[model samples]
Target chain A: MKIEKKDVEYIADLSRLELTGEEKELYSAQLGDILSWMDELNKADTSKVEPTAHILGLENVLRSDLPEPFPDREAILKLAPQRELDFIKVPKVIE
Target chain B: MNNFETVIGLEVHAQLNTATKMFCPCPQADYKAGANSAICPVCTGQPGTLPAANVKAVELGVKTGLALNCRVNEISIFARKNYFYPDLPKSYQVSQFDRPLCEAGSVEIDLKPSGSKTIRVARAHLEEDAGKSLHALGSRALDYTLVDFNRCGVPLIEIVSEPDISSADEAHAYLTELKRILQWAGVSQCDMEKGELRCDVNISLKAAAVKELGQKVEIKNLNSFKAVKDAINSEIARQTAMIERGETVAQDTRLWNEKEQKTVPMRSKEMAHDYRYFPEPDLVPLRIAAARLETAKNELGELPRARKTRFMKDFGLNNYDAGVLTSDRCLSAYFEACMKEAPPSAAEGEAKAVANLITGEFFARANELKVNPEDYLSKTISPVSLVKLAALTSAGKLSASAAKTVFAGSWGTGKTPEALMGELGLAQVSDSVQIEAWAREAIAANPDAAKDFKNGNEKALGPIVGMVMKKSGGKANPRLANEAIKKILAA
Candidate 1:
């Protein structure tokens, strides 16, 4: 599968990323190379193997439904670029 | 110029009543708390944060599916739905895409004046909720929006209904029954006012003469069931008018404006976001064991429809009364508890008596206290006390009028019916001797009426009975008082 410039532009727009013309061309070639490598990997016969979502041998890692207090309130709020009276302010977002 | 048929499909988002966020340990506390106070690094979308699924949320999703008679899948996958918004801290939601938890379920909605209609549920998928963007639209000082991550990472299940609904009333009934089922299964609170339940409606109008469907328009921000019905109704009208005017209806997203009572366009179809969905790498496939599935099915308990049918068949309650009793799970449980304690011989009568107390006086008291009936039952009243009150009214030990007084006074006081009755002097004076004395006094006082009564004037007996009731401080059972008055008059 070939990744065209338009496809890269559409993906960048979806991700809310702004890319220059040169960078868009660069990513188009880079993404196409990545896809060709994936195609090469797909050529091998792996039909007997099961599709794996996670490679780790981990399952059912869960926490009980008991709640503890959130320890760092002020620090979390300060991480935001703009803050007003314990709230994180951003550009107005209408529906 | 042409008759049209409306098609509506609803998508409902129900927040799970979990103790913490779906992927993090941040407490899902009330949003009224200080903003950012409940934030954790994982929920705040900090880099290198890994998310783990909540077992309780998955269990709740399964329970809901079983209650709706859906086919629960043994394996489901979580996918990353990538999008960008201020409220979505992670810029993507962990949601079920190709594989959902439940599928192929249907709900039965009762229609007016006739039979019930079945709405097909396409699928129900588990997802994490986004935070809310608090907008300062009308304020003069700040015109920017604020972000609150308190709601981020909360667990939710999105139920998508097929386009089987033909009218607004049927749509409303579908949502109402769905909410009741979820609440009964103890899956979610399903409270619309608290944003625990939200709905989005998709509607289109097709000419009755044609078989093809028209362009579909999506409506959002419906905070209540009534809003959903109104939005669908008005959207149908708007689309029908457009077609009549020889204009094609444009597919768009609209918001329900409660003040104007109309749906206004929020965005056009061309601006729709492309959610690039891929399998989530951080979480493993959720595998439901056969034992776990059996446990969920057993935990569903008696659903509303079956319980309502039983109340009608076994308890001999009418349709409307049974529906009112089974509407709330807590109420039905309370009634069943009362029935177990009622006298064995008069079980049907006692059940009706308890139902009346709950629907009548109990509802009124709960309204006055500004609490939900179920909450009131747990906090203010006890089922044993309620059964005893019904028993008193049934055995003729308490006058019906005095029962009302005792009900009002006993709310939240932890006083039993007997204690309240004793303190208020509401016990019935059913002694024949005392009743005869009052009847005799009334007879002697009114010589003219007494003579008329002895002359076989049965209507004249009413005044004597009234006087007897008044002399007993209105504590005499009116039926027994009437009988005693007749006996005295005949002698």
Candidate 2:
């Protein structure tokens, strides 16, 4: 699972990140150490242990049939990088 | 033809009908509200914030498994599905691994001409929805790619099926049935049109005599069932042609181009070793107490299958009628509401006629409008008005043609059936005297056709019936028209 220096460079390119030579070497070692821990996790006995998806094991959580109005409109638009007249503005996708 | 059998499996992602997203109390809003409206810091994957799993989502996951006839797991767990994309926060996703909420469920789907097949369900688990990424690669009108976190952290139930499907038709049937069950159970909208429901397809081809499978290719992002069928059929053709040419199918994730009608390799598919799934440290093991599961099962109102059977038995509907009505929970509610005050007075049988009126008239119009049965029921049409209308139609006071017009008015104005009929002056032409005159005119105009009817040509009756209908401005109750025409023609 250890990400080698060369593979890390390739992945960083795929991820569109600008990495310096020194930072790349440092991250390679750091990623390798993390992978070794994951290796330990892969070795654990999961044969008898069931995988948990969500806590509480509750079932059938549903919304009431009543449709409610959108709340806190002003608060949501504030988090956007750009906004125009109470709207979050972004690059147009379709030509 | 080279002898190669297709081995196909399906991974279905169904958005839970939960009010809030899986990881937080943020409302599960996919679109419409606004960008980032439903997102929280936990969903945005801020550094110090942790997520608390949505318990309701887990319950829905188990219920979906149970519906497919799967055994519920005593303890289920979650793992991080590591991936890096702008849409997915934290560069990873929390999902189920070796332990799933339910295992060993199977759905039996019927295919026309080919009969039936049982698809084995591998497992079902809960997961969170991802944020959306808007790509503006080739556009000058945009500065950079856009994104919306409105869908971030919405709940999802994923069902994995064994490689049991061999044909596209069977796959379509399985998905259709699965959507029906989830919708009827009040679990999910499963609306492929809205993108709330989605599917990932796995396909491979092996030599007909080969016992094992060929290289498996996973295809992603097929939204519609038609698209699934088209993609699979095209892949089978492509794989078969390749194998015939001594070329091997590459194991990878291919994106299905619905418009181009082919699968193009997005990238070489990852082996499970790549994602490196590990149990999430923040989440604990989900324990399903037997009592809780039992209570959930009890609370699950009659499922579509059971309700369909009862509609056939108790409601005196045929198999098709029962299936059509009970396939949708909302439509079924509408049907029962219409039947509530209906007086059983059919010349044939009371319940049977009542069932026919519902399955025949109401559903016919509902389908034409493409309205979800629930939305139709949620509107102003009520049982009292519906039953009163059915009684009028049964008593030969409302013609079928006129009923359609009145039914549309009932939907538009939210007016009771009687009020609409009174306002429009659409009462049936059951006055034997007035209908008899039109019947006489119709018989005389089609003298030869009438003679043909006398000569025992049963089909001639149809033309005469149409003539009488047109003569009455489509207002003649069919039953009264038939009797009046018979009496006049005999005279």
- Name the candidate that leads on lDDT: 1
Report DockQ per prediction, comma-separated.
Answer: 0.59, 0.16
How does model 2 fare in lDDT? 0.77
How close is chain B to the truth by TM-score, in each candidate?
0.90, 0.83
Worst 10 residues of 2 chain B by lDDT: B267-276
- Tens-digit lDDT track for model 2 on B97-125? 88778899998887786557899999888
Give the per-residue lDDT of model 1 (tens digit) for B226-298.
8998898888889989999999998788999989989999953423657888888888888888999999878
Worst 10 residues of 1 chain B by lDDT: B267-276
Runs off by more than 4 Å, candidate 1: A1-5, A20-52, A68-70, B268-271, B366-385, B405-437, B443-462, B483-491
The best candidate in terms of DockQ: 1
Clashing residue pairs for model 1: none
